[model samples]
Target: MTCFSPKFMAFCAALACLSGQAPADTAQGAHVSIELNALEPIEDACRISFLVQNGHDTDIEQAVYEAVLFDTEGRVDRLTLFDFGALPAARPRVRQFLVPGLSCADLGRLLINGVETCTGDGIPADACTDGLELQSRADVEVLG
Candidate 1:
């Protein structure tokens, strides 16, 4: 027969749980997350807001992405470059763009085509587009 103390059994259980989970840093991975925060109607245009987060340890001097907007009928509405300037490390910032001659209700989807420019002092070349995560809080869908 084998016997184990209560303290030893508890320690073993804790170790097993820890082993099943990934480390905190690696869990988030090395990437940038862009969240479509809101859409507002302004005059005859649509104001699109984005919540940008840099998960890297360094600052990003300039980050621009080629975005494509689709109409409610799933047809391409317009293509433009959104420049989110100077993203700080581990911080979130809101950037808004006004689409002239477009209505907020007509937007159905937003697609992140690719990274137009991602530059920083020590950041990787593909830091902005690599493993990019897209989210949306509005009715429109955001895809990468």
Candidate 2:
């Protein structure tokens, strides 16, 4: 079963077409989905892996995404930025980041947040304007 809630999925779907750029958020739109694959706890950091899937027919030259992690106190504990380069069409790209001093239990929630930049075929792309999805597993693992 999927770890993401239906409400969150709907939110992502609704934001998927937030832009009006051609092939970006238009009817003939391009889309991307972000999923939290795994969270690995290291010495003083959390190794986060995100699976970015390009749903558009065009190649995504680059995409900058954010992962907002809330702490146990329900406050914004850490905000991490991740970049996925050369994401080919219709393929899932795995991007990993090491967040210092973050544990799986410390994470209260994960937000797809937003895309900072997107490019396609050497030109600017509105991939994120169409909004991207985010999901996290209920059962997260911890590793030393």
Best by the TM-score measure: 1
As for candidate 2, its clashing pairs are 16-130, 44-101, 45-101
Looking at candidate 1, the ten consecutive residues that score lowest on lDDT are 16-25
Per-residue error (Å), model 1, residue 23: 9.9
Which lDDT tens digits does candidate 1 get at residues 1-144?
A: 122676665555345335532111443465788999999999999999998888777889999999999999999999999999999876778999999999999999999999999999989999998888899999999999
Candidate 1: list runs displaced more than 4 Å.
1-24
Q: Please, what is the whole-model Cα lDDT of each candidate in the order they appear? A: 0.84, 0.65
Give each model a TM-score: 0.82, 0.69
Worst 10 residues of 2 by lDDT: 19-28
- Model 2 scores a TM of 0.69
How well is each residue in 40-82 modelled by candidate 2, as lDDT tens digits?
8888888878776776777888778765777767788877777
Clashes of each: 0, 3
Q: What are the per-model C-alpha RMSD values against the true structure?
A: 8.5, 9.3
